[model samples]
Target: MRFFIVISSLSKLLKYMYYIYTHSSMVEGKRCMQTNESSKEQKVKVSGLTFAQLKKWVTVDLGMKPYRAQQLFSWIHLKRVISFHQMTDISLSARNRLDRAGEITALESCDTIAADDGTVKYSFALEDSEVIESVLIPDSPRLTACLSTQAGCRCGCTFCQTGRGGFRRNLRTDEIVAQLYGLQSSSNDRITNVVFMGMGEPMDNFPALSDALSIISDDRGICIGARKITVSTVGIPGGIEKLTQLDGQYGLAVSLHSAVESTRLKLVPVAKTLPLRELKRDMKDYISRKGRRITLEYCLIAGINDSLEEASALAEFAGDIECKINLLIYNPVEGAPYRRPDTESVNRFMHYLYPRCQAVMLRRSRGSDIAAACGQLGPGARND
Candidate 1:
């Protein structure tokens, strides 16, 4: 396990370079860069901001005292207040002013499913009416929250259902944070960890993703330690480079479903542009700079990427790079051509690669019954 987590923190893990998702209000089907004039006069959403950012906004923009900022922080985060009227300690006048200036953004609960395996999945509606899902995975005392970075995904990994639904707009910072707030309200087991491995690729919406990370990790806020958070990506070169620059506080998981170039291209269409060779270079650079090992995630699909030849390639690919190869059994997706490998095939695949790689583990899917497994999130699934 030493080689599995040679370096501390997820700062060195996850993400890709280049993004097609743009942050702009749709104007006649055109997307333009948002402006500082309140995004052309849209009210601020205070839910996802860090304490320092909240203080600056309250003191400067909202004309509130510095101490009042702390009060708002406690009201919103510690107390988990949903509306301004709930802040009884704050002056009525202040509450009225806050209502006029900004909103304490919260998601509207729509539907939820509890898997027999103790995995609870929640579907919430965003302000724009986009539906996103989050999963609460129970493992004894530790319950992990898998949050989404976007409403849908841009990286069209053929094996993933989220990609099949096509990309929607990138989530605002507040929307990203609100998922955790929504999950906490539903689950009794204090969320012990978070994984940005839900609906979309974390790197496609890097700006909002980065802001949500800081806000989530801040002691005055949600306070989930950075190391307990993991950001999984499809190995974007630019995103990997940027992840290395951040303070090593989180874990990194790259969804390298296949190591062979030809097979990987088919699995992750984005691989056509961000070839495997470059992805490895940045991964190596991430280790050298952050001194942390990344977890290479490979989802074993029947017949497609489960061959012994693929195992040999993966071993050779991760040979010099310090990383833990995490093997996953494919979870079924509706309308997808792929099939889950049988038990014997999975055993053969895992055994062949276990000795060849520096470190390896077969991470079982937790919520297949409720369609909450990895690569199974998206629209068009009828959950019972």
Candidate 2:
């Protein structure tokens, strides 16, 4: 009787699986899939706008006086208005007009994790009910905010906790910029640097990421230089090519955790889709056009890809490319098979890279007490 029941369940499960495989395309073609975008009209974040765009918006759309644009910009960004009603400097009539146009980005701070070392991790609620993380690291004189470009990641890097969460959706420019506002407004330590190395792949969400960078770089606004901003990617082709067209002096970091193609594919699965040879070529072209050095991030894992031979190969791999190798100590994640390499092995690997390229062994920052190290930020933390 038990055998018969088991067989019946197996048969039913197989039938459903067969139907899903056959009709998968039909499910994908539906516009209103699972996202909340199905209900509310998609609104851009106010933090994502530049003074020029805001000026054009106020003058052309709202039919406000030219000087009013400057006042509005001051009220929103400089004053850090928490609510629309707080834009008291702007006339009620004009504010009502702007309100009707759906111009404001409604954001609510969800949660914050402040480490003993003054590193604060903030989670912001998006209009779509998805949450993204932004981290502020204050090392006295140098304050850095690690920002995210998407709600979740699609890069599928095997070593990453956030990437394992799978792709949710691209965050708007406003969502990205709101992170800066949140950090600056909440913390006393002013952020001097920003790195797009948090939750999602920055290059994948190119337009929104670029817009967020522009808003931060605006002189009359936050006024952060392009040099102070670092955009990291898993080596997307179209994104890298598009980056060449832009004339910003921002820094770029490539997550080149392994030099070996097979090993890299095992770690960063995107390598299978965008292989190293082509990626190297696109990156070389980017360096030529931009005329700047790029940072190659290498994560050292024990007994896996950190052997002396692999280190030597990595040196040869980075040869004369206008690049610097950032040897990162692998931040251990729960259920991850690999362990962090010892100091001896890490030094041996750095010795090989030093001869071939400009290299620096960036020590993992504080926050291990709170589990905020590299690849360690997520709901799935090791209990042991």
Candidate 3:
């Protein structure tokens, strides 16, 4: 009787062990499947598509009605919904289909630092875990949101902290528009102006920039006026030509730190390839085609490009084109071998160009205290 009882006990123990092992294996398999699905979802960035593309995808690819496309567009771009589940107007089956198709990745606000001034700086977390920074400058009636076009810049402008970090990758069109949407959602004030002057060079990422412009300026979408959006570049001739070809009424700002070719080359290494004369001609052509005045962004670095002579050269360069000169005192970047001009020097420099240029405005560094000022944005940047 004792032997029979022991035998029964052993059988029960063996069965329990087998069940535990099988359960563990099943759990592991399920986890692996979940990971694979997550990765697949990451690959399909629905936000990367424009409204028109999303409409086509839904109507043609997902076998949904054409009207559903408009709803989807409004939900993502206008409403800024993070998930298809939040799209109440979309049917359950259609939502599931859209979910299976891809994921709608929105920019997560990692950190936001406000300056003593009314400027607010936001650090956005990308889908790939990379971070980009944007600035919101509150100027009473007109609130300006400065947007970044690339994760890091390759322009190699010595004074720019973004270039100091080296290039990562150009931001997609959706990523560009996401910045505007994110800002609108966060701020109480409406964004009246958008400037591509945050981190990277806009012209370097022209295709994405153009698409973003279209979505932002579209009345059916974000509804920002084309004139209110300004794209700043370190002078790319091909990009200027492309902008002219598109006949976009968007404003253009050239980062002409120094009007002299050799001086400009030193300041903007990319200028070595894109000479001042060629860039000048392209600007003239763009002005002629678009019938809009270009803004010359001159970062006046003390003892470097803030000399009266450089200012005069800049005035001469602006002679033919109807342009406004935005004289910005260099915002100090850590490790950058440059300094901001004193009040006297800044005034002197602007005084020289004031007579020659169409209009000259001194741009005060808004978020310099938080490293959110012009030429001061990058991973390496720190707030003082």
Question: Candidate 1's residue-wise lDDT over 1-384, tens digit each?
Answer: 776575533324421111223322221111222323354367678887778889877766654667878888888877789898999988887786677667888885798888999898889988778999999998977889999999888888888999999999899888988899899988766888999999999988888888888888877767899888999999765898777777755788899998899999999999887899999998888778877788999999999999999988998899998999988898888888999899999898888977778889999788988989899888975445
Give the clashing pairs for model 2.
Answer: none
Whole-model Cα lDDT of every candidate shown, in order: 0.83, 0.74, 0.83
RMSD (CA, angstroms), candidate 1: 16.3
Over 282-323, each residue of candidate 2 has an lDDT whose tens digit, in order, gives 778878887788888888899878998888767777885788
Q: Tens-digit lDDT track for model 3 on 1-384?
A: 999999999999999987775444333121223433665546456776767777766655554666877887787777879899999987786676677666776776799999999898999998777799999999999999999999999888999999999999999988888888888889888899999998898888988888888888877667888999998889865988887776459898999999988888889999977798899999988888888999999998888888888887888888988888888888888888998889999989988888877899998779889999889899878666
lDDT of 3 at 174: 80
Displacement of the residue 216 alpha carbon in candidate 3, Å = 1.2
Error of 2 at 42 (Å): 6.1
Residue 341 of model 2, lDDT score: 90
Q: Report the number of clashing residue pairs per model.
A: 9, 0, 0
User: Candidate 2, which segments miss by more than 4 Å at Cα?
Assistant: 1-44, 106-108, 382-384
Model 1 CA lDDT for position 373: 89
Alpha carbon lDDT of residue 210, candidate 3? 84
> In terms of lDDT, which candidate is stronger, 2 or 3?
3
What is the alpha-carbon lDDT for the whole of candidate 3? 0.83
